[model samples]
Target chain A: MSGLRRGSVCLGLCLVAALTANAQTDAPSRRSGYHDMGKPLQAMQDDDMANPGMLWVGEGANLWNQRFAAADKSCADCHGAVQSMSGVAARYPAFTAGSDQPVTLEQRINLCRTQNQRADRLADGSRELMALTAVVAHQSRNQPIAPPDDPRLRPFIAAGEALYRLRQGQLNLSCAQCHDDNAGRKLAGVTIPQAHPTGYPIYRLEWQSLGSLKRRLRNCLVGMRAEPYAPDAPEYVQLELFLMDRARGLKLETPGVRP
Target chain B: MGNAVHAEDGLRPYRIVGDAIPAPLTGEAGDPERGRAIVANRRVGMCLRCHSGPFPQERFQGTLAPPLTGAGSRWTEKQLRLRIVDAAQLNRDTIMPPYYRTDGLERVAKGFAGKPILSAEQIEDVVAFLATLKDQ
Candidate 1:
């Protein structure tokens, strides 16, 4: 009877181990290939380094609440509440019919200003745009990055996949060579995090400020000895669409803090 | 700050180059100037960022990756060439980016349409420069 009971206990332990591994690998709404989620790198650090994205979000909240326009309308006037904007950032990099390009959250936010608020489109990389984007991204913290699966974006995703696989520059390195093959390996002193789309618009400690996804992409290209795409380029847009799809079900922690 | 640390103590031969697969090079002779260009070219080699070399134009280089002065003494021309081309093929878990393989890349820059990042000639040139790096 005791031997039978021991066998049963071993089986139970094995089942528990399997379940834990499954939870890690097959967890729905979890970012694919990311090490840690929800917690900012700042929080992970023993020392207190204020998150730059949070700083920008504070500026955005002020801008949202402050009065604007001749009608004295502000972003918060209609949205009034901040939490309603939650989950909004995750659905971005959307398709545009006229341009036939995947529009990023920054472009969409600017479009709202131009169309609804009767305001000029914010210049790309402006402080105001950063603040606005930070606030929107902050709202979507922990929400899965559910890039809308519209048929229009299929071509871009395909293009991005091709780009990810193709070699570039004199060194002849591809994006997949490092991010996919050597991911999670130690390079020099830093651990190579899998190039997942979970923590984007991140505040990199190296940069000492918040940076957009495009910036990171450009950095990768440079690292590969490949010429970087122009800012807001079509190739990058296609790549972003593909990344969003690949990172499907991962939480959007935009304006995220990262080492 | 000093190149001595990178040259003397920074990396072990096994660690810096990683487990690189040995492959036959496709070019005949190497060109150091072309190699220099490849190293400097942001769209090509971009070696100046990581390893300090004969490039006088570059000032700030990475301490994490070792200097490439005595590379030729440490590794043969063919071995250095293969490592430059694809370090990951030898070691499945190497952080060094593979430079020559044409398969499985994403979001290639528009200028590199339908072509490998570098031609066989360029790889030879970079290898030539690496061959010049010997401990004197």
Candidate 2:
């Protein structure tokens, strides 16, 4: 286990170095959203009591163990304690069998509820989905994010990367302009941290709600003066895969707080 | 502010009003005061989100693009009007959102369909405010 971790760590460091290597020599080491936040927001994320996202995390804990009569099952029934699910969410957006489609952690959770538990699929941003996904994600709170490198993901990864760099919308901005080239810089007094998908199902004060990564992407599209995609669009999945791949070594901060 | 402009009530197409560089977007004169409010507002104009300028009192001013501090001195009112209406017409690589243009945009949220982010009057208003910032 330690050896595998070391290898992934090496890959993670290589990725980081490559990013900087591509930039001017004067640039400082990249920083996370956590590093760019003010003291108050940081403290808020640290204290579970003050963290509004914890409310959703708690809800997820209940849903895990709660039995659904319709499905004649509960997540805990098949998976046992939620604790065992640790480090599981960190390895998601996995290239699955059959079509080899990459499934996000949220999609995987929904798959289990519908297929194994015979329960209705949860809607995106539904409190139940947020709670369950958040709960499952919380288990891997500090685990390093590492999507598998199956050869199958290569095409999708390339497609996702293309989308990241592709300019779209009336504003003609791509994800790279703000996150890759100008990350850690101030934009409207807000630090545009590298577009890392570390903390998700995150609590955003702006939304005054916990939302998925897809929600943030939609918001970015809107900010770009482009129309936002519908919930869980294939384009979003492609983008999510790229974001997670870019964020390979960052520790999961699910239920993270953002201003 | 003449005749109350009364522009934001609905959607309409915009045409350049004069032959000059600093032409009015429409026959109506823009109220610089109203324009200032819209530019500072995050939801409405949100200029400061990606622009830094002479507004020292504002907080969280981003430094993503060229500041608007000397915009009036650099570009004529007509030029500013056109840029605000659709910056893509100027620089295809520009990240500035077109405040008034409504064509060729993909996947706009249902609420904003067929509607520009800022109304035509609001675009003029932003141009008005931007025109007040002389280089000095």
Candidate 3:
């Protein structure tokens, strides 16, 4: 069994090597991740019940009501009915009440757990963290993304735009070269999107798992053969803010499906 | 030959004399067969990411730039070498990444900050493969 597993791993690497040799990764195909997917993936996203990401949504719902032993609290106690939280996620990567640092929903959840419930911070990329973020973001489903307006966020936004345009990696490609400059063309069968941040806790076919927006950003950095920043890195939050700003007024597609 | 130079031979920045770069890219002759593989491979040249070509076997050609077909007829081997080295000289805003040049780029991975994306031999090989793409 171990030998078979090793063989499969080697095959995967060889396939990757073969595919990369034939790559045209520099196109500017700026459609949304949604528009890039095929029919089967689209259908999976349309029906919440059939959407595998909803499984995370389900887990989130359960986490929302469970009491935390640390502070004897649950999200339900303070936030009230989940439905009432609608439109909340739409405005995030926003300036929190106490801190000036803008935060994504994942960061907010960690803050709530540590500050309000006195619970330990959820591990980055942990299943529970994804679940809670999905639950919170799902409340804002179908709402237009409304990233908060505040001058305090200006510096971060500028930094993000700089990062977006700056080329990186051995390929010497930048996000702008593809996402901004060539948003609608194909890159060896994959469509590159304008790279909006409306979808968080997305169900990506490539991952075969639901993940946060930050996770995807890290993937892009890795794809460039560059070292990826950590999940909690300020760059991720700032990039999240900038993307949300660019996608301003576009409807939120939380628990979104992507290929 | 051209494709014979391995990346491990280590890359040195080429002088982009523009309309004057010496051809056969590296000092050696390039193997057209190997050169062709480098252009198609995602791990190396990734030329298809922006340009289309007569690579029928390789599906998903990009439409961002001009097709690679007829390239041999349009540009001399020397010209192709310079452009591939760094097209920024011809068109400052060209989305094409510098396949061989390594200086003056921003936010490069620490280890690759000074290294060209393609080794000198790889560039010669790709140029050789491209030179074969005559308008038929």
Which candidate number has the best DockQ? 2
Q: Where is model 3 chain B poorest over a 10-residue stretch in terms of lDDT?
A: B1-10
Cα TM-score per model: 0.65, 0.78, 0.85
Listing every candidate in turn, what is its Cα RMSD in Å to the true structure after a full C-alpha superposition?
A: 10.3, 8.9, 14.6
Native-to-model Cα distance after best TM-score fit, residue A153 in candidate 2, in Å: 1.9
Best by TM-score: 3
Write model 2 residue lDDT over B17-111, tens digit each, in one string: 34222446566778899999998887788788888877778977988878989999998887787677767666676677767766666655566
**Interface RMSD of the predictions, in order shown?**
6.0, 2.5, 2.2
Location of the lowest summed lDDT over 10 successive residues in candidate 2 chain A: A23-32
Q: What does candidate 1's lDDT look like per residue over B76-123, in tens digits?
A: 876786577656556654545556654444445555534544656788
Runs in model 3 deviating more than 4 A are A1-31, B1-15
Query: Of the candidates numbered 2 and 3, which has the greater TM-score value?
Result: 3
Kindly give the stretch of ten consecutive residues in candidate 1 chain A with the minimal lDDT sum. Answer: A29-38
Q: Write the residue-wise lDDT of candidate 1 on A77-138 in tens digits.
A: 88877777898788778875454577887887776677668787887777788888888777
| Interface RMSD against the true structure, candidate 3 | 2.2
